[model samples]
Target: MFTNLLAFHSIFRWLVLAALFATCILFVYKHFTNKILSLKDYRFLQVVCLILNIQFILGVLLFSKSQLALLFWDNFQETVKLRQPRFFGLEHPSMMILGILLFNCFTFKIRNKINTKEAFTYFSKRFILILIIILSSIPWSFSPLTHRPNYRSLELTNF
Candidate 1:
């Protein structure tokens, strides 16, 4: 069950990433075009929230299984003492959560109002925030993200 869950988590990452990317683009375009918030906007936001929630659950399961909870302790050197464990246990989860939080902020802020200008201003800024989250969550060895998957497969792999 654990292995199956892990594989599901791995496979789901691609969908989450793609949805985020598309939503980011849509937000950016809406910002410039001053488009009205439509049902599609709500749907996109819902998808993002749903995926983040799933990832959070999967992460919790992974953490519960091993020493992951220990590595996330507030100490830096203690956390990075190892490689794979540190990346999977700490960096990836933390950054992903931060991204989710930022995305939520956008959704929460925009859901109440109907003013086109305000929506554009608010969501555009939120879109930028989401972009920042996406940028940070990317596991670029060149950047702060050190735990990114190198390749994506349609089917989950054991290796």
Candidate 2:
């Protein structure tokens, strides 16, 4: 069950990224073209926010059930000394939560503003910032600080 959850979480990251990217592009196009914010645009934003919320829940479940997290708690000092454990135990989760908070803040701000142009401008900036945070927090293949599942095998391989 844990392995399945992990695999689902890993693959879902791509969907989050894709949705965010699409929303950002759409916002940019609409802003530049002087298009008014429509219901579709708002729906897109809501979907992206919903996806992030789901990812957060999955991450919390993984964190609680993970053996690595248990190890980190057992050996707090030593775990903090290592890159991979530190990233998983602290960095990744913290950054992801922070990104979600930022997204929520900007999303509410966008929703409240009556001016369409201003809302789009705010969304563009917020989306770009959130994307940066998400990208940085992700455990990319080349990242020495963290580890991720192997895409080819779809197995929960160790870092």
Best-performing candidate as measured by lDDT: 2
Q: After superposing candidate 1, which stretches have Cα over 4 Å from the reference?
A: 67-79, 138-159
Error of 2 at 130 (Å): 1.1
Cα lDDT tens digits, model 1, 35-91, are: 777766776787888887887788778667645546546455776686666776676
Residue 45 of model 2 has an lDDT of 82
lDDT of 2 at 3: 77
Please give the TM-score that candidate 2 achieves against the real structure.
0.88
Model 2 C-alpha lDDT per residue in residues 1-159, reported as the tens digit of each score: 677777878888888888887887887688778987776777778888899999999999999988877788789988889787778888889999999989877877777764466778767776788889889999987877675753523455653
Candidate 1 residue 76 C-alpha distance from true site, Å = 8.8
lDDT of 2: 0.81
Among these predictions, the greatest TM-score belongs to 2
Q: What is the lDDT of residue 49 in candidate 2?
A: 89
